[model samples]
Every structure is written in C-alpha cells, then in structure tokens.
Target: MAITIALAGNPNSGKSTLFNSLTGSNQYVGNWPGVTVEQKTGKYKKDKEVHFTDLPGIYSLSPYTLEEVVSRDYLVNERPDVIIDVVDATNIERNLFLATQLLELGIPVVIALNMMDVVRKNNDFIDIKKLEKDLGCKIVEISALKNENIDKLIETAKSVAGQKKMTYQEFEEDVEKYIKEIEEFSVIKDNPAKRWLAVKLFEQDEKIMKEFPLYGKETRRLEEIIEEAEEKYDDDGEGIITDGRYNFVSNVTKDTVKKGRKGMTTSDKIDRIVTNRFLSIPIFVGVITLVYIIAINFVGGPVTDWVNDVFFTEIIGENFRGFLENAGTSEFLTSLLVDGIIAGVGAVLGFLPVIAVLFLFIAILEDIGYMSRIAFILDRVFRKFGLSGKSFIPILMGTGCSVPAIMGTRTIESDNDRRMTIMTASFMPCGAKLDVIAMFAAFLGGSWWYAPIWYFGGIMAVVVSGIILKKTKYFSGDPAPFVMELPEYHMPSARNIFKATWFRCKAFIVKAGTVILLATVAVFLLKSISLDGHFVDFNADPEDSILAGFGKIIAPIFAPLGFGDWMASVATILGLVAKEIVVGTYGVLAGIGEVGAEDSSMVALVASKFSVASAFAFVFFNQLTVPCFAATGAIKEEMGSNKWFGLAIGYQLLFSYTVAFMIYQFGRVIEGGSFNLMTGLAVVVLFIYGYLLFRKDRSKLENKNFSNKENDEVVKYESN
Candidate 1:
C-alpha cells in the first residue's frame, strides 16, 4: 500500500517550497474536485510508494472559503497516514495556529520547521526537542529552499506514518471539561476525533453543527453550555477556544524559542518605500513600464524581426514559392499555400519571442513577492471605487489569460464585486491579444512606448468600468474588506522563475499550433475563394473574394471607428475566434508574397489602410471587446446565470464600440476633417457616457420608511 502523507500549513509558510523539495519532479497539479482551488500531489523522490498530498495553504480548517473547506474535507475524509505540518520558524507564532488545528484532527503529525536558515541567520533559535515534547509531535528543522535536513524530515514523517498513532494535545481546563462532556453525550460514534468534534460544536462551527448527528435536547443543552462559558469568559465560544489554543502555543514558544533583535528587518525596510503612500503607484507604473520597454523593444524586438523577416518570409516563403513554381503548381494552389496560410500563421508566430520575454518578466515579478505589494498598495484606491484590492489579483492574472482570471474571482467573497470583476477582468490584454498589440505598435512606427500605453489603457478600462458598474443597481454594494498577509520579500529563485515562464510560454506555443493554426487556415480559405464565381486566381484582387462580401455586410457597423474597409472588418470579426487572428488575417489580405530581407510591404500596406488614430481605435476595440469563446464559457460557469453572462458580453461590446467610436470620430474632428453624421453621433454618445459617469447611485438614496424609525427601535429590530 502507498504510504500517504498530507502537507498543510498557513499561506506563505514555505509549504510549497517543502513540497517542491520533497517531491522534486514527481508532482501532479489540478483543481480540487468541484472547486477551483488548486490541489497538488506528488511521490517522494526516493520512494515512489511514499505519496505526499500538498493541501491548499490555509490558516485554519474553517469552512469559510473554498480552500479551507477543501482542506478540511480531505483531512477528515481521506485521512492520510501522517500529516506533515510545515511551519515557518521565523513566524512561528502565527504558523502555530494552523499547526494546533491540524493536531486536533486525530492524525499523527510531524512538524517540519521550515526556513531554519532565515531563523539561524537572524540569530534566533528554537529548541526542537522541547517543542516536540510540548506539542506531542515529532519535530524537524529544515531549510526547504536550501535542501537542508530534507532526508531526515522525510524519514521521520514516514516513521510516524508507519506507527499510525494519534497525537493529542491538552487545552485549557474549562475548554477541556466541556469537550469531554460533549464527547460523552455525542452520538457520533464513527468519528475518530470525537473530542475535536465536540470542541467544534462548542465553537459553533456551522458546518459541523449541521452535519453531526445530535438529539434536539442535546443540541439545546450544548448551546446552553457554550453560552454559559461565553458569559463567564466575557467572549464568544469561538473566541474562547481561539484564545485557549493561543495560550497553549504561547506556553510552548516561551519555553522553547529564543528571539533575535527585531527593530527593522530587511523586508520591513524595503516595504517602507515600496508600500509608501505617495511613492507606491508611481513605482509600480515605472516597474511595469520598464518591463514592457525591455520585452517589446530592447530585447524581444530583434529576435521577432528575425523570425518574421528571415525565418518565415525570406527562407520559408521564398523557398516554398520557388519549389511550387519549379514543380508547375497551379497558380491558385500556390496563392493558398504562400499568400494565405504561411503568411497568416507566420505573422502570429513571429511574435513568439516577445511573448516569451514578457511572460518571463511577469513571472520574475510574481516570484519576488512584489506582485502582492501591488495589491496591498492598491487596496485603498480600489475601495474608493467600490472594489476590494482582491479584485486586482484577478485583473493581474488576466494579463496571462482571461479564462483562469475569470475563475480566480472565486477568492473574492462579495457577490457584486466578484461578478463585476468577472465582467471586467477580460479588459486587460491577455497573451493572445498581445500579438495584435505588437502588430499595431509596429505599424505605428515601432515605438516601444505604445506597449505601456496600451497596457495602461487596459488597466484604465478596468478601473473606469469598475467605477461605472458600481453605481448601477445590479452591481451596487460595498466591497468586502481587504485583508491579506504580505509575504517577506526575497530574491526570486531562478529555477522557479524559469519553470513558470516555460509553462506559460509553452501554453502560448501550444495554442499557436492548435487554435491559432486552425483559425489562420480558415481565414486563408475564406479570403482565397471568390464571390464572383469560384476560387480566385493567384493575381486576383482580394476585394472580390467571398470574405470581402461578408466583410462588406459588417463593414458599415465599424465605419464610425474609421476602419470601415472590408479587410479590417473581416479581421475584427475573426478576432472573436482568437485575438491573434486579427494580425494573421491582415497578413493574409495584404498579400505580400515571398517577403524579402527588408520586407516593409506588409507594414506599409497596413499603414496605407489605417491612419495612426484609426489604428489606435482598432487596437482599443480588439483589446476591450469580449474575449474569446473559452473565456465566455468561464464567465458563464462562474456567473452561474446565462442572463448575467449575456449582460457581461453585451457590456464589453458596447463599451469597446463606444470607446473606439469616440477615438476615431473625435480624432478626425481634431484634424480639421469634415463634421459628419457619425461625428455628431459620437458627440451624443460622449454626453450620455459622461452622464452615466457622474450619475448618482440610486442604491444610496435614503428611504423615509426606514429613516423615520427610532435608533433604539432599529437596533432592537436588527438584533432580534
């Protein structure tokens, strides 16, 4: 039989580092069943039979969040052979809170005191033998990051698992007396942790109270006992139990742990500036700007140019065209192969280097713990717009992919905030959309600053949309309080950063081979066939193609946005399949066959088709529009209502269209162009948008019926 051990701990307690060290390369990651929370399991590096399940990093086994519920259910139902509770030795007090809860689950536990290097470096010491004696569990000190004493920790955990003996710790006298009484009177015989269940009963854990079988009179008597205890302690029953556990932890730590000087640690000194009130946002902006500048222009630009000019255009396209001509290939077939397929797919793939560099920079930021500080600094600003800083996490994740970002809203507790976040998260440009942005920036003179401009534009889209939606009745509500622990800032591990960047870039590459490939093929075929009769010849104008006919039907709708041409309309429509297809379709329609070393024809073709203002409008429209079908499905699943999903899609389309329209029409007006009907419509739309932006929130209106009530009466009514 496989020996199973579960790893549980508070968030940022080095639990992940320990799991990575123990499991090495033998790990599988997926979501917990029926929840979006991540679950990880792996086999020990040395012994394949020794399986380790890394439970979600949770502070306690309370059923408040999905992660907590999943962790609690797994521990109670699966009942691993041994529980390895990894605790951060530097922050032992807070970590011990979870350790104490894990010990109460009636399973043999081995405590892995992680980050001992940090502790030792700070001149702190923990008496391992004394801690083991006091906590009734085997203890091992190990630096998971440094791979120190890992073998001993694993051996000790396996031995404890083999013993299969439960470890119990005594609580306060009053709490212990009530727990024993409840256990004796309880009829839950199958539960191994009867005392723990009784303690949960006293703490008024709603899930336990609902699931555990107890007589009606016994339930009433249990509540009475809890109330009497609360009265005696001058605190709620849950608070009393929490205090008792802390008291026990204090006794253990006071005897076994030695503290070092703590005026200001390195992390604190850094946080003082990074998390400062006035400097935080500007610093964040500078960091993001620097990342984009380096990725798009400085490092990634030359590599992308080579892929496009040398690899795809000169080498692949020219050689294939030469071979086709030598083999007497049909003119139509040659056009389909070179002008249609390779051009379209290659246009998107040429930017793969840029995407990889961008993902690498973002991964480094995340690994260094600066991303969390971005959330911490933005919380106050988010609250003013009726959103919690927690919403920023999903928005940040959206930069990679909107599907996961939409699902990430599960962490936000408020329904209105979560739904609003789901609706707006896709406004951030995802990896697929980056191809379109890169192409547009290249068309607009290859300026590096366009990258940050579009990025900041996406963020502003999210923020402005958040503020607007909050005033509407469907989304109007106070956001939940933001509370999150800031992990200590440290140098990012190169291995972890590379792994993350590789995985993200690999996903993009896979999509390029699969979804983007299919979309490009379809676009090529559509543009190759002629509406006049049959397929078009090699030199035939693409305007007569079947795609142009369809594009003409939808072209009028985008006339106000200035890209009313058939090709631009067609590309915009195909973008719904995949955003990268927008650029791919342009490459196909431009028909710059057999691009040479200095291939400026395609860029010139795009420049001729769109002015700078219209190009910006086109990019903005695609960036802010409803995301691809996969993200829509996620929105539907997360919103749990087709009505809300439809509303979200409608909102995205309307907002993007309105913004794009204003950019083009008003831009033309500023250039001393003629004032047309479309320009007048843009003025009207702007006025309505401004009205909505400044509109009073109907939800905040006072009601006479409620306001007329006396304060004491209102208080009494609410209490009852």
Candidate 2:
C-alpha cells in the first residue's frame, strides 16, 4: 500500500532541503485549490508508491495566517497517514510548539531533527530516546543539506505510517478539566480528533468556532468555561493555552537538550558585527555596491562584450546576411531575418551575463541566511513610514522579477499592506530593467555606481510612496509587527545555488527567445512598411513608415520628460510588451540588429536623438513604470479584483511619469539650460509631492502598535 506522508515545519528549518532530497525531480508544483499559495507534492524517489506532500512552512496549526490555515485544514481534513516534521535542532524548544499541535491529529509523527550537524559542532547533545518518549513520536537526526541519514529518516517514517499516536503533554489540571468537559459533553462524540477539537473549542479558535458553532445553552456553557479559565489564569483563552504549551515544551527541552559551549555561538558573534545598529546600514550598502561592481562592470562586462560584438553582430548577422544575399533572397526577407530577429533578440540576450551573475550573489545571500537579517535591520526604517518590514522581502525579490515578488506578498496578513506592496514592487528595477540601466549608463558614460544607484533609488521610491499613502484613507495603518528567525550561518549548498540561478536565468532566456522575438518582427515590419503599404528601407528614411507616424502622434505626451523623439517613444511603447524589448526596439531602429550598452551605434543613437537629461529621464520612465505584460497579470491575480488592479496600474503610470518629468526639468536647469513653462510645472508637482509626503496619518484604525500576537520571548524561532 502507498503511504501518504506530509512534511511540515517552521520556515528556515531545512524542510525544503529535505523535501528536495527525498523527491528529487519527481515533484509537481501548483497552487492549493482556491488560493495562490504554492503547493508541492511528489512520490518518493526511492519508492514511487510512497507519496509525500510538502505542506506550507508554518509555526503552528493556528488559523491566524494563510499558511497556518492551509496546513491545519489539510492535516485535519485530508488526514495524511504519517508526518515528518522538520524541526531545527538548535531551537527545539520553539519548534516543539508545532510538534505539540501536530501530535493531536491522531496521525503517526516522525521528527526529523534537522541541522544536527550544527548541534554536534557546538558539542551539544540531545537525548532522542527521552524526547521521543515525551512527544510520542519517533526521532531521527539528519542534515538535510548534506543528505546525511535521509534514507533512515524515510524508512522510520514509513515504518510507523498507519499507526495512531496521541500527544502525551497535558495542560494544567484545571484547564484540562474544562477541556475534558467539552470533549465529553459538547464536542464531537466518538471522534478520534475529539480531544483536539475540544481544546480548540476551549481556546475559542475563531475558525473552529464558526465551523462547529453552538447555540442556546451550549453557547452560554462555552462562554462560562472560557471566562472561568481567563479569570483564574489572568489571561485570555489563547494566551492561557499558549503558556501551557510553552511550559510543556520548556520542561521537555530541559530534560532532553544538553548544553556545552554556552558563551555565544558563531552566528551570534557574526550578528553582533553585521547586525550592529551603527554599522549595519553602511555594511549592507557596501556589500550591495561591491556585488554590483563585480557583476556589472568587472566579470560580466567582458562576456557581455563578446556576446554583443563577436557572437551576434559579427557571426550571426554577417553569416546570415551573406547566405541570404547569395541565395537571391528579397531585401524585405533578408532585412527581416537578419536585422529583425537576430538583431533584436541578440540585443536583449547579451545582458544575460550581467543578470546571471547578480542572481548568483542573491542566491548565495539567501542560502546562507543573511537575507532574514536584512528584514530585521530595515524594519526600524520601514515602520516609521507605515510600511511593514515584510515589505522588504517583496521589494528585494522584485529586484530579480516582479511576478514572484507580487506573489510573495501573500505572506502579509493585512489586505491593505499586501495591496500597497503589489502596487509599488514594480518600482524596483528587475532583471529586464537592468538592461535599460546598463544601456543608459554606457550612453551617458556613467560611473561604476550607476546600476547600484537605481536599486537604492527604487527603495527610496517605495519609502516615499508609503509615506504619501499613509496620510490617505486607503493605506493608513501602522506597520505590521516584524518577526523573523535568523538561521545559523553555514556554507551555502552548491546544488541549491545552482538550481536557483538556472531557474531564474532560464526564464529570462525563454522570454527573449519567444516574446521579444515575435514583438521585434512586428516592430520591424511596421517600421519598414509605409502608411501607403509599400515596402521601404526603415534604416534609410525612417519617418515615412507607419510606426514613425504612430510614434509622432503620441510623442508629445512624454515631451515634458524630454525624450520627445519618435524612436524613444516607440521604444517606450514596446517596453510594455517586455522591458527588455525597449533595448531590442532601439537595436532594430539603429539598423545595427544587435545592441549593447557598450556598442558605439547604440551610444550614437542616444547622443544624436537625446540630451543627457532626456536620456536619464528615458531610463527612469522604463525603470519604474507599470511592469511588463506577465507582471501585470500577476498584479491582477494578487489583487483579485479588477477595480484594484486598475487602480494599481493607474497609480504606477502616474508615479513613473511624474518622477521622470521632475528629474528631466530639474536636471536641465542644473545643466545651465533655459527655464520654460515646464520648469514652473515641475516646481508645482514637487510641492504637491512634498505636501503628501509630510502629511499626518489619517488612519481610521487605532494608533496603537499591533504586532504579532505571539510572545516573542517564547516563540522566538518561528519565522514566516
């Protein structure tokens, strides 16, 4: 018989590593029904008959967050035969809070003591036999990242699959008396989960109460039991039960966990320096700046040059054109094949080196667990602006791509914060926008700090937007409480890093091959054919074509931003299809067929058609505008309402345009140019922006800081 086992854990507990080791390439990923949160399931690599479900990482079975609800529902409703709960061995006291709840489901449970290597490294020891006996579960010590004893862990889980076990830990005697009364008299009779359900009732869990609501005399009795417990314990029902669970876990840990070196672990020492209040921000800035320098200007520069110069312009364009001419191909066909497809797609693909290198550094930071500290450090800054520290996760993720970043907002518990995050995340320059930044930097002979400046600029935009919106009725709430666990520093797993890089790079390559290729063909055809439908050389005349006429029609809308040239307008319009297509469009227009930031033809195109201020404005417009087609779809799905999606898109467009306008007019004045009507308008816009930014909070909700409900001292290891 096939054994169904659910793998569950707290975030950063090595659950994901263990799942990948067990399932390998046999897994399938999708959303849980009716929700956008990802669900992963697979059959065991060693034995296909043994099925495994990787449940969402959550701290407890409480229905407070979507992840917790999804996990709790699946365990209670689906009733998986057995569970492998991955617990961080170094913080077992906190992780056991989840273990206590999982034990009540009447399913066999196996505790996978992850990161045991770290425990051993510290000269600490755990009494597994005693721990197992107390928790009523089997225990296995394994390092998931190293694939140590993984087979043994699976074997033990399967061996106990169908057997039933109940949690042995009990609350205080008086609390247990009321819980038993509910189980025996009011809650489900003859149910295996009756003990768990009765406890849920006693605690007055909102979701559970709604699911199995009582009426008449039952309601009064339920209220009596809860009020009596609250009066006796001097706490709410949830708090009382929470304290009971913590007491139990504390006792168990004292008996099973043995201390060795107690001064401070290596991670604690590193955090003292890296997370120091005075030095943290500067250190982060230095780390990020150094990372981009190595990726963009040093290592990635040479390879990008080769891809743009020798590979695309010399080899593909030259060879293809020569072959087409020899075969007596028509000019239209030759131009379409060489200049249209090869030129445009190659221009975008040349930046793959820069993108892949940057993603590698990000992957390393995430795998080594430093990314969590970033949230903690930035929380103090973000909270004052009415934005949650959780906002940084999506904003940082947006530096890679906005699609996944928007989806990541699901972790935020508040609707207003999630909506605000989805709207502003596009301000971050994504992998595609990096091409725009690189192109413009080379166009203007910008310094090594150019690319990094755009990243920090994006963060500033999010902060400024948060401040403005906090004074409005729609987005005025105190920042959500930020709580995260800092995992111990360790060597990054090579396999994990490689997988992250490959997946992200593959998406970029695929889009260039498909979306940009087709869009470039259309752009070339429209520019090559005249309004009268006659074939003309777009490189020779350019103004007589349909695309030119269309660009001229809409060019005035961006005239204030200074890039009023037809080709610049054409490039910005095509950017809506995909941000990288803007580069491809410029390449196709220049008739160079392959463009890079360092290419003389692209630099000449900008110098002839744009001033320095106009070029900066053009780059800023593309950097912060409404994202490409795919990301807009993600925004729509995340918002889950057409009204909100429209509002988000409208807001993004207005924000991008106003910022670009201000930059150009102010820059023109800075460059000793004549002031005009547009300059006066820019000043007015600046005044309005400053007023909104400095306005007082107008939130309808109470001003009190509402953090996570759990006591941080007790559940210190739980992370989103």
Candidate 3:
C-alpha cells in the first residue's frame, strides 16, 4: 500500500523548503479539490511508495482563513497515514499551538523541529527527550534551509507512521470536565476524528456544528455545556479553546527549553530605524528611489543605449535591409521583415537588461525578509483608509505579474476588502511595463528620477484609490485584520535571486519573440497600406496611410491629455494587448525603414515629435491603466462576475485619464505655456478629487444588486 504523508505547519516555518528537498523535481502542483488555493503533492525521491502532500500553512486547525480551512478539510477527509509537522524551533512556543491541534486528529505525527541552526546560534537549548515525553510524539531537530539531518527526520517519521498512535493532550482540571462529558455524549464516538470533532463542538464552531448533525434538544444540551464553560472561564468558546492551547504550549516550552539572556538581535536593531513610526515612510521612499536610480540610470542604462544605438539600429537593421535588397527581394517584403518586425521587437528587447536588475532587487528584498516589514510598517496607514497591510502585500507581488497578485487577494477575509484589493492591485507597473518605464527614462536622456517617479506613482495611486472608495456605500466596512510573521533578516541567497530573475526575464523574452513579433508585423501592414488599398511608402505621404486615418478617428478623445497625434494615440490603444508592445509600436512608427533614419532613432524620433508635457503624460497613462488581457481575466475571475470586472476596468481607465490630464495640463504651464481651457478643466478635476477624498463614510448597503458568490461566503466566514 502507498503511504501518504501530509506536511503541516504555521506560515514561515520552512515547510516548503523541506517539501522541495524531499520531492526533488517530482512535485505536481494544482488547485485544491474545489477551491483556488494551490495544492502540491509529490512522490518521495528516495522512496516512491512514500507520497507527500504539502498542505497550506496555517495557525490552527480551524476554518478561519482559507488556508486553514483547506488544510483542516484535507486532514479530516483524506486521513493521511502519517504527518510531518514542521515547526520553527526558534519560535516553538507559538508554533506548538498547531502541533497540539494536529495530535487531536488521531494521525501519527512526527514533529520536525526546523530552524535549529538559528536556535543554536542564539545560544538557546531545547531538551528533545523532554519534549517528546510531554507531547507523546517523536521529534527531530533539523534545518530545512541547510538540509541538515533531513534523512534522519524522514526515517523517524516512517518508523512512527502506523506503529504509534498519539492521543490528544490533556487539559487542566477546569477544562477537563467539559472534555470528559464530550467523549461520552458525542455522536461521532466511533469516528476517526472524534476528539477533534468533540473539541470543535465545544468551541461552538459553526462550520463544525453544521457538519455533525445534532437534533434540537441534543444541540441545546451541547450549548449548555459550552455556556457553562464560558461562564467559568469568562470568555467565548473560541477564546476559551485558544487560551487552553496556549496554556499547554506555555507549560511544555517552560519545562523543555532553556533561553539565553534577552537582548535585541541584529534584525531587531535594523527594525528600530527602518520601522520607526515617524521615519519609516520617508526611509521606505528613499530606499525605493535609490533602487530605481541604480537599476535604470546607473546599471541598466548604458547597456540598453548600446543595444538600441549600436546593436539594433547599426548592426541588425542596416545589414538585414542590405542583404534582403541584394537578394532581389521587393522593398515591400524587405521593409516588412526588417523595419516592421525587427525594429519593433528590438525596441522592446533593448530594455530587458533593466528588467533583470529590477527583478533582482525584488527577489533580494523578498529573501531578506524586508517585504514583510514593509507591509507591517504600512498597516497603520492602510487601516485608516479601510484596508490593512494584507492588501498591500498583493500590490507588492504585482511587481512580478498581475495575475498572481490579483489571485493573492483570496487570503483577505472581507469581501469588500478583497474586491478593493483586486481592483487596485494592477495599478502597480508589472514586469511587462518595465520596458515602457525604461523607454521613457531613456527618452529623457536616462534621467535618474524618471523610473522612481513612475514606479512609486503607481503605489500612491493604489493608496489614494483605497481612501476615496472606502467612503462609498458599497465598500464601507471595517478592514480585515492583518496578521503576519516578520522573519529575521539574513543575507540573500545568490542562487535563488538569479533563478527568480532568469524566470521573469525568460518570460519577457519569449513574449517578445512571439506576441510582440506578430503585433509589430500587423502594425507595419496597417501603416504601409493607404486608404485606397495600395502599398504606400511611409517616407512619402505617411499621414495618408491606413494607421494614421484610424488613429485620427480616436486621437480627439485624448486631446485633453495631450499626445493628440496619431502615433501616440495608436500606441496607447495597443497597450491594452500588452504593455511591452507600446515601445514596439513607437519603433514601428519612427520610420526606421528608410535609409539614413539611423541617427534619428525611436526615442529620438519620439522626442522630436513630443514636448516634455505630452511625453510624460503618455508614460503615466500606461503605468496606471488595466495592465493586459491576462490580468483582466484574473480580475474577472477573482471578482466572480462581469459587472464587477466591468466596474474595475472602468475605474482604471477613468483614473488613468484623469491623472494623465492633470500631469499634461499642469506640466504645460510649468514648461512656460500660458493656461488654456484644458488647464482650467484640470483645476475642476482636482476639486472633484478633493470632494471624494474628504467625503464621510457611508453605511453598508445591501449587496444583492450585484451577483457575487464570494461575497455571501465571505460574510459567513468567521474572522479569527
């Protein structure tokens, strides 16, 4: 028979590291049975008969968060043959709460105490024998990160798999009374999860109550037992149970663990300045600005300049055109292949170096554990706007891609909060938009402030949107509580950082070769064909081409925000397909097809046609707009309906246009142009924004108007 093992633990306990080690490359990843939460199962590399399931990390076996529910449901329904409980040894007291609950399910469990290296370094010692005696389970101390004693851990777990069955931990006398009665009177007396079910019933868990059917009088009797216990403890059932578990964990740690003198660690010392209430926001802003400066201006800029100026413009374009013409190819086919596809795709690929640097910094922050601290520092401010730091995490995750960022909102408990996060998370410029940002920075002669301004401007938009929308009736509510474990700071792993950077850059390069290549060819055909359907030379009568006529029809819509020319208008519209293609479109329209067009490059070409005001507005609009089709599908899936998806897209477009309009009109005046009608209109837009920002919160209204299934389920979920 195949032996199934479930790995369960709290978040940040190094459970995933162990899973990766045990499974090697044999893992299979997919969704949970009926939910969107990810599920990972793999056959052990050493022994295929020993299958492992990596459960989502959770604090307790309660249906609190989606993760906890999925874990609890799997443990109960599947009843795996054994469990390896990965516990963070440095924080054993808090971690033991989950370990205590896991014992009650009657599955044989082996506690794999992780992070023992950190414990040893801190001068703390834990007695393994005493802990095993108290918890009545096998224990092994290992470091998942260093792969220390991993084989020993699995061997011990296999020995305890079916040979030993551990009973639930005993409670204090006061609580023992209710438990003894539950064992005698419970309906699931013969069930495998009898003890666990009995405890859930005593805690008055609604989900658990719904599961085990009890008639009217039987339910009232159980309620009486719960009420009496609550009266004695002076706490609700959930509180009473949670306190009991903590109390037991406290006793176990006190007896078996020896601690060193209390002093702040290095991570704690750094947090003092970085997380200081008054200085944190400014310090965060400074750090991000410095990162962008390094990536865009210092590190990635000179290389990209060479790629655009020397590589694409000099080598590829000139050589490819000459060779094609020499081979007796027609001018039309030669231009279509070289000018249309090569120039456009080359324009986007020129910025790949910058994206690699940006992704490297993102991976480093994640590995160093500062991302959690950033979220922690922002929680107070986020709460004031009817959101918590939980929403901000997904926004940070959007730095990679918007799909997973939108999907990350599932962990937020409130419907209003989840919907708001999903709507605004894409406001951040994803990896796809990094090229557009770099293009603008290059156009400005590689100005250091250009990238940071565009990057942080997107974050500020999310914050400001949250503040304004929280006042509306449809979204009025208290925010979801944010609970996160801030891990200790450490040096980033170079291997992990490079792996992350390569995957993101690889995806970008793949898209450039396929989607972007096709899109650029289509653009070339449109611009080369005239209104009467004959091929027209772009060097002569470029305005009479089909693309120019089509762009002319939609150019007036964007006139208020400047960039009313056909090229800029067409680029902005095509960005909806993929943001990277915006830079490609500019390359195509620059007329790089004609000889001697080399020195007047794409960025140089665009700069000659646009003033500073219109160019800045063009970049800013793409930064805040709905990212692409994939992200839109993510929004629709997470929002659960066409109505909410439509609202999200509508909000994004209107917000992007309004901000771009202000930037253009105010910027024009700042550049020494006299105030015009559009400048006065910008003032009116600012006044409307002030009204929205200062508005009072409205009462929560019935949400029956919009059909959202997640809304009803979220309302029913208990927030713990």
Best by lDDT: 2
lDDT of 1 by residue, 22-52 (tens): 8988999877898767788999999999999
Give the alpha carbon lDDT tens digit for every residue of 1-720 in model 3: 679999999899999989988998899987787777778999989999989999998999888888899999999989998989999998899999999999999899999999998889989999999999999899999988788999999888888777545666888686777776776555778788778888888887888888887777777888898888888889987788888889899999999999874888878899999899898899888888887888789865678877766777678888888899899998888888888998899888888888888889988998888888888888977777677899998888998888889988877888898899998998888888888888777668777677788768888899888988787876677788998998888787787678778888898999999889998998889999999999887566568889899999999998888888888889888888889889899888875544343354677778776788888888888888877888888899889889888989999999999999999999999999999888999999999999998776655333432336566667778552
Could you give candidate 2's per-residue lDDT for residues 510-614 as a string of tens digits? 999999999889889989889999988545767889999999999999999998888999899999989999989877887665443356475577688888788
TM-score of each: 0.93, 0.93, 0.92
Runs in model 3 deviating more than 4 A are 21-30, 42-51, 184-186, 216-224, 231-236, 315-330, 538-541, 591-600, 700-720
Better of 2 and 3 by TM-score: 2
Displacement of residue 509 (Cα, Å) in model 2 is 0.4
